[model samples]
Target: MAQQERGKRSRRSILEAAARVFDERGYDAASTNEILARTGLTRGSLYHHFPSKQAIALALVEAHGEALRPPERPVRLQSVIDLTLEFARRLQSDPLLRASVRLTIEQSSFDCPPRTTYDQSFEAILALLQEADRHQEVLPGVDVQEAASTIVGSFTGLQTMSQAYSGRADLLERIGIFWKLLLPGIATPGLIGHLRTTLPDD
Candidate 1:
């Protein structure tokens, strides 16, 4: 058990180091040597866990998908909103999440096809919207699938702008405004009234 736990920790360290390097240097410019240096792990150890940089990037994408799994909430639409807000918070601070976004964009250059990461995000949101539809929380005439796509697209654009302009310091605020603008058009009146645009503390 101890040996297995140690192996998990070592793999985690490698992935995290790789995320930081990728987030800083981008996929094309990031080097395995830099990842090794960041983890303080030997070449042999890294190869034992991840055979190639492509493998590391794929693993990071998988991790990002897992991170997007939001906690279940009674109000499904609220879950969707909360998930986006939480993602913005993590994008502001989590190197793994930030790196995942970069890897998804740069995967084509590295011969790693980027479909599962984004598809998973889309499917998750679609499922939430469908559930909200069943609950009558969605406004009349709102197409659940289309609404899901719009939410994801809007968040992605806003997040990219936040990254470019301020390193995401204003991300939560922008995300809040995003929800405020979107909810009125998609959510039922009662649901929209209860939904929060700002983070709870704000």
Candidate 2:
């Protein structure tokens, strides 16, 4: 049991160290040595957890999905809004998520075919929008799937721009503006007035 726990810790350390390197240098320029230097772990330890730098990058990209999982809310539309706001907020502090976003945009660096990170994000939002639809929270005539795609695409642009402009210092505020403009189109008129665009008080 102790060995298993240690292995988990070691893997986490490798991943986090790699995330820092990837976030700073991007996938093509980041090196295993840099990740090792960051973690102070030997090559063998890293290989035990990840076979190659691409493997580490892939792992980070996959972990991005975990960050997007929002807690359930009585108002599903609000859940979607909160999820976006929270993700924007996390980008300011979470190296893992920032690295994942970088890796996703630099998909050309990957050896595999183009990834489905966008599709994954779209699916998550689509599920919430579907729930909102069933609850009559979505505006009539709004296609939930299209709305989901738009949300994902818009967020991708928003975060990229936020990162470039202010290192995402203003991301939460940008997301608030985003929802203010977008919600009225997709949310039921009654629900639109109630949706919180800003992050809820911590």
Candidate 3:
């Protein structure tokens, strides 16, 4: 049991160290050596856990969803809004998420399927939107799937622009603006007025 726990810790260390390198240098320029240096782990140890840098990148990309999963709320639409705001908030402090976002956009640097990250994001948002639809939060005739896709795509662009312009310092504010404009189109008029577009005060 102790050995297994240690292994888990070691793996987490490797992933986090790799995340720092990937976030800073991007996938193509990031090297295993830099990750090892960051973690102070030997080559053999890293290879034992992740055979290649691409494997580490894949693992980070897959784990990105964990950060975005919002707790359930009485108002499902609010939960969806909270999820986006939470993700933006996390990007400011979480290196793993930053690395995953960088890896996701720098798709050409790695062999991981280009659509996998986007598809996962779309599915998660779709589930939330479907729930919102059931709650009558969504406007009549609005296509939840299409709305989910738009949300994912728009967020992708929003974060990319935020990262470029502000290094994500203003991501939360940008997401607030996003929901303000988006809610009117997809959410019921009654629900739109109730949903909070901005992040709650920290």
Candidate 4:
């Protein structure tokens, strides 16, 4: 049991280190040596856990996806707003998550299927939108699946632009703007008036 726990810790260390290197250099420019240097681990140890750099990048993408799971809320539409706000906060503060986003965008270079990340995110948002539609919180004519896709695509473009121009320093504010722009079309007037576009204070 102890040996297994140690292995898990070691694997986490490698992943964390790889995330940092990948975040800084991007996937193609990121080097295994840099990852190893960051982890302070021998090549054998890293290879024992991740067979290749591409595997590490894939794992990073999965980690970010897991981090994005929305917290449940009594009002489903509010939950959707909270989900985007929470992710925006993480994008500003979390290195692993930031790296994961980078890896996902650059997946083509790693020969990874880009849709894996998008599909996972789309399904999560789609489930929430479907629930909201059933609750009548969604606007009368909105298609839940289509709305979900728009939300995902919008955020992806917004975050990429934010990262490029501001290093995500303005991500939370950008998310608020995104929600403000998006809510009018998706939420009923009653829900739109009450939905929180910004996350609460830290």
Task: For candidate 1, write residues 153-193 as lDDT tens digits.
Answer: 88888988999999999999998898888888988987777
Candidate with top lDDT is 3
**Which residue pairs does candidate 2 place in steric collision?**
none
RMSD of 2: 1.3
lDDT of 2 by residue, 11-104 (tens): 9999999899888888888999989998988899999999999899888888888887976899999999999988888889999999988888
Tell me the RMSD of model 1 versus the true structure. Answer: 1.6
Candidate 4: segments with Cα more than 4 A from true spot: none
Note the Cα lDDT for every prediction shown: 0.86, 0.88, 0.89, 0.86
Residue 73, model 4: lDDT of 90
Quality of model 2 by C-alpha lDDT: 0.88
Query: lDDT tens digits, residues 1-202, model 4?
Result: 9999989999999998888888888899998999999888899999999999989988887887776688889899888888888888888878888888887777447765565677888888999999999999988888888899999899999999998899888988888898899889988887777788887666
User: Between which residue pairs do clashes occur in model 1?
Assistant: none
Cα lDDT for residue 163, model 1? 90
Mind sharing the TM-score for model 3? Answer: 0.95
